[model samples]
Target: MYRLLAVDDDPAVCRALFDYFSSRGFFVATALSAGEALRLSQTPPPFDCAVVDVLLPDQSGLKLCQAIKETGAAVVFLSALGSEDDRVQGFLSGGDDYLCKPYSLAELEQRVLARIRARQGTRAQQVLRFGPVCIRLDRRQVEVEGRPLELTCSEFDILVFLAQHRDAPYTQDAIYRAIWNQPGLDGTHTVQVHVAQLRKKLAAALPEHSLIQTVWGKGYRFSPPPTA
Candidate 1:
């Protein structure tokens, strides 16, 4: 099982993440502050991945992230502050990914899984191919029927998530959680809007309508190509 170290001051957040990821077949250890994280990172075997809050009680998460990077662990920043500058700082601090606050556990799981897959080298097939659409994991590139799809960062992320789990029915709320990473925004209509955009762009590129299908009260699923 993969091991993850999570650093956050909020006990509730830490507990939620620890339980959520653990239930998903991960060995997760929680740290309530930067000091605890730093101390844990120095131990033998270390941790395979880390989820860090941008703020900590003892020190800044950026600093903690930097320290964790030195340990050669994959770093993901989870912050309440979602500024471009903040994200840039996360990357500069050696973090591989950045997630804003109020994030959904599903989205967090997706990002964490991606990082874990990357670290596993040959075991991680980061690319997903459906019909003519191909998504390259490392380069973060997407192409449909040989034509590149110009998608915003979040759009691409959502598509990648759906494509990877094609045909699996998921709710709009669940999709929002996976894509936007905003948990409390459950009843919000943001997910529908993004899905519409995703479908429009993908449909224009691909020769298919069932690429993304709504399952009525359930959510969306990536439909397979019809047999010729």
Candidate 2:
């Protein structure tokens, strides 16, 4: 069964969503604020999709969406702010879809399912192998030489992104935007830091092969050994 999280400050809306989705076979959870949603997100078996309101009691839902994206869950923003800029900001903050308030619960369900389906489609190749490194998309796992390699969510995402586009050099700004789904407002320093950490981990596992290559004047690329 698909796991769904619905976040809205209105108890009525939350109850409605819970009832609507639950009746349709979704395992639904509801939260009234961003903090509560974050707390619930920590539970095992991560949610497949989150329906979040743009305006939250404690924090902006855009920020919440970023945090949820790091967990590899699809996010849909539901808001009364229906302007173009609002929708743009939602997408920039890693939201997979944006729906205006007073939305049809049916439409919301369709949007949520669509986003989850899109994500699943992208991960259709369940396992990706690059020499001694193996990525299991379904399980969100990485193994090096048949031994499990622990990687933070961001690191695993970066690895998969690079591996999918093997040999193509992407600038730090590009990589940051691709992974975070936001413009590099504070520069690409965060991407640099994550890449550095990821490289260090991979180096420790594969001493001889350099799977990720940094291109001077460019950015980075996944260049596994040819024999793999």
Candidate 3:
């Protein structure tokens, strides 16, 4: 059975999907508001897929979708507003599928299942493997020599940013803005520091592998050396 999170303000909607999905071999969890949905996501063994109503009492479902997608969860937006722009915005907000209200619960189940399979396929692609080091973005797991390796919050976020944009150049200011969420605000040479710390950790883990490449004049790139 797959884990499912269903969020909607209407009690009937939430209970209906919850009961239906649960009957369809799914362990479903229902939340009346976006805040409840987020709280549920914080626990271990993250939800494989989330069915969220666009109109929530607390927060926007699209925002929840974006937040959970960063952790590798598939999102399906459920809303009454069915327009071209609404659907487009849902997709742009990281929703895998958008379903209009007055829709079939059976169809929602199928869409959720399809999203789960799609997420499985996409997760493999998001992983970064360099020799014995493996970074699983979906799970936020960093492994060395097939074992989990603990990393600082800053180190993990920065490393993932570089890997996702491999072969690209990013100055300290850009990285700071991306990781620190301080857009257009530059401070000290912080990128220089965390990069070195990441390098040191990598060196200690995989002595034979070179994962990060320094582009002189530019910032840096994540280029894992080819295996011999």
Best by TM-score: 2
* lDDT score for candidate 2 against the true structure: 0.84
What C-alpha lDDT values do all the predictions have?
0.78, 0.84, 0.79
> On a 0 to 100 scale, what is the lDDT of residue 193 in model 1?
81
Clashing pairs in 3: none
CA lDDT, candidate 2, residue 37: 96
Q: Give the alpha carbon lDDT tens digit for every residue of 114-174 in model 1.
A: 8867775634466666667678876788887788888877677667667656746777776
What does candidate 2 score on TM?
0.55
Model 1 CA deviation exceeding 4 Å by range: 122-228
How many backbone clashes does every candidate have? 2, 0, 0
Q: Which candidate is the best by lDDT?
A: 2
Q: Is candidate 2 or candidate 3 better by TM-score?
A: 2
Ranked candidates (TM-score, high to low): 2, 3, 1
CA error at residue 133 for candidate 2, angstroms: 25
